[model samples]
Target: MPLPEFNLYPDFNTVRLSHAYLNVSDLAASKAFYCDTLGLQITDESETHVYLRAMEERGHHCLVLQKSDAPGTVDAVGFKTYDEADLDRAEAWFQAQGRPTQWVIRPYQGRTLLTSDNLGIPLEFYHKMDRLPSIHQKYALYNGVKPLRIDHFNCFSPDVDASVAFYNSMGFRVTEYTEDEDSKRLWAAWMHRKGGVHDMAFTNGTGPRLHHVAFWVPTPLNIIDLLDLMATTGYVDNIERGPGRHGISNAFFLYVLDPDGHRIEIYCSDYQTVDPDLEPIKWDLTDPQRQTLWGAPAPKSWFEHGTRFTDAETRDSDIAASPIIAP
Candidate 1:
């Protein structure tokens, strides 16, 4: 079948990265890491899941930690669209792809779509979600400061080419790519949909898995503030990497591990690609410049920390059976 018209997928004017789902082995530990160290506030909780929001938003939650029998698994990434029309259009787009989706409307979330990506991660889309006004607006104690929302999620897939094809088929345009011509393998590529990336990303991996969930802060200083807080909260060891700039988006970044080992990145200053005709970037995997414009390869940990999705969800039969390389 011909690909559906992508512009018809709700034509979202802007998309705010909403939440990340973690299947945590220890609920309390995960809760403490987010609230105590990261400074997120609890918005809701039940026996099975805990929902949190940045101090700025009264949204029901920005991150959901679901109690899973297995730790270190990423359940899904959530994105917020503008309205019901966007949700309806997105659902139509998925339905045309012959993919299975579960639609849900909860007490906290309005109409939402829980669908599987080619990488096996469950992806959620919603509109008409509500959030409280920033606390900074209410008190001088927080004057002129508020936490920005989530930025994007990096996902893993055994076959990068297949993952790329799946996302492109659904209108996710590539913003950057890393390839190895001699090996004839596509290692990774950054794709964007709605606007900024908040969906599937394919990394060179054995199968579907999650790499990290990223949140955006308004300024670079917030990253430093977070680092200081990490030290103060006794989560100093959780600092996985720097206060550095990424070549891909030219955004400053810091990566840390949650209590459950799921990765969270704080970043700022990525450029916008809302132009009608933005081209994809091609970076050679072997090119040192791909990882850093002026540095060494991403440590092995950066490559290994991302999680993989199950075969049934990715909708790609080949990936479901592939064996992952162990670090």
Candidate 2:
């Protein structure tokens, strides 16, 4: 089925993916993985939580780790809007659809609206965050991959078509997608509010789990350097996949597991998508190159494992649903 017309929900103008909230069992261990090893800078921290950002980020944080006894899980995926009114528009639109919504006062952030997507993935919308000095030129402070900024998030949804439609209504444009070869059913989509390929993507999978949150490294060699650092630091087992190119986005990428088992990707070399008339690139699900340009198959774990998200208000695990498999 074709995607619903764009702007189905009027005045919903999301700017970009801003941050991802994760529940981790050990804050210290996660800090070591994300900060010391991955090169993210610690912006703020408390006994129960830590806020981190990449070198190029002006915002206070792009990733938040909250202390929890449960296994590592995603708490929410956050997006920034053009202004505070855009967040109000989103809240009203979601309420009109009968989705539960709440206003939250988060530290270092302006007024926030928390809601769940159709698939029950926790979503947050906000307009303001505390700004910090960019550390891109601070070469002496760089370490590991020396990631520049948080790039994108890949999430799992049982219904890819519905997820695409939901985000499309929120002004996200599809830059690339995959569909079943025979049935032509939507399997996955890369959507964006920013100029690059995708600020967020949805893949065909179980429930509202998080596949990975990506950080933009300066170059492909940065990915290699991180691998070397990981190996030297006895974190070789954390390497999950690639320093390979993806035919879909044409990005050089590497995926690794943090100490809490949450996945993060170090990515580089993707083109911008600023043309309004740009047609979305489509791929057949059976095409190996759709996922990897170098013909490397993704591991079974990559397909089956992802961090579950918790409900924003109730703090309960979102129920997993069966995926719509292509015939």
Candidate 3:
């Protein structure tokens, strides 16, 4: 399929994938996994919610855990804007596109615009977040894998082409993409606002589900260290896949399931994508190395499973689309 016309979309001046909100059945267990096991620091906490940030983060939180009856569900995927006006622009932009939108006041965040993408994935946009002290140099506070910061989010969409076009209209540049060999239909796309390989990725799958939220580790060895920690901590079964390099982004990664089955990825070593004239890299869907540089295939669960997202206004699970993997 041809790419979307970039001129048709308004540029809302998005900064990056700043944070993600997740619903966990047990806040304590989720805290233990994220804070103790993953080495993220808790910024604030309550009975129902806990806010966390990475060691290198200055933002109040990069991840929020909200206590809920439903496990493995996402409340929303969030993005940062360049300024307060950008939030207003985003609100107007979503409304112009005929998508339902709401203004929300979140704790420790400035005015937020809540809306859904073309695929109905819940999204949050904000210009400011409360700042916290960075612990990047504090070795004493480090534990477990000690991830640096949030890198990106991978979401499943029934229609990759449509999702890509929607994101393209939002000023997200495609860095890489996968297409079916026989049909040449788009199977997946990696998009970015922060000039890395991707700030968000859309894969052809059952619709409107979160595949995984990735955090950047300092090095490849950190990925190995994380696997070791998981093995020693009696949470070895949660180690779902990898300590492998992806041919697409050139990122070394490991995917693990949290206590509530929310998938999180430990990632490192992706190249910068800041050049304006850089052409997006493309891959054939059938290429073995596309998924893993070393040729190991992703597990069925990795391809087939993802966490469902909740509607921002109704607070109910959004309807998911049927799976559509290419044969």
Global lDDT of each candidate: 0.67, 0.85, 0.86
Most lDDT-accurate candidate: 3
Q: What is the C-alpha lDDT profile of model 1 across 259-302, one tens digit per residue?
A: 77888888778787776467666765556655655554566687
Which order, best to worst by lDDT? 3, 2, 1
**Tens digits of lDDT, candidate 2, 1-327:** 675554523567888999998999889988999999999999999999999999989999999999987757887889999888898889899998778899998889999999988878888999999988878898998997998999999987777887898788778888998876555568789988889999989877676789999999989999998999999998999999988999999999999999888999999999999876578998877677877897777887787778888752222223243222222
lDDT of 2: 0.85
Runs of candidate 2 exceeding 4 Å displacement: 312-327
TM-score of 1: 0.81
Q: Clash pairs of candidate 2?
A: none
Error of 2 at 241 (Å): 0.5
- Which candidate do you rate higher for lDDT, 1 or 2? 2
Better of 1 and 3 by lDDT: 3
Q: What lDDT tens digits, residue by residue, belong to model 3 across residues 1-327?
A: 876644324558888999999999999999999998998999999999999999889999999999998878898999999889998888888998889899998999989999999878889999888887768999999888878999999998777888888888888988899877555578889998888999999887777889999999898988888888899998999999898999999999999999999999999999999875578898877788888988887887987788988852222222233222323
Question: What is the model-wide C-alpha lDDT for candidate 1?
Answer: 0.67
Clashes of each: 12, 0, 0
Worst 10 residues of 1 by lDDT: 317-326
Order the candidates by TM-score, highest first: 3, 2, 1
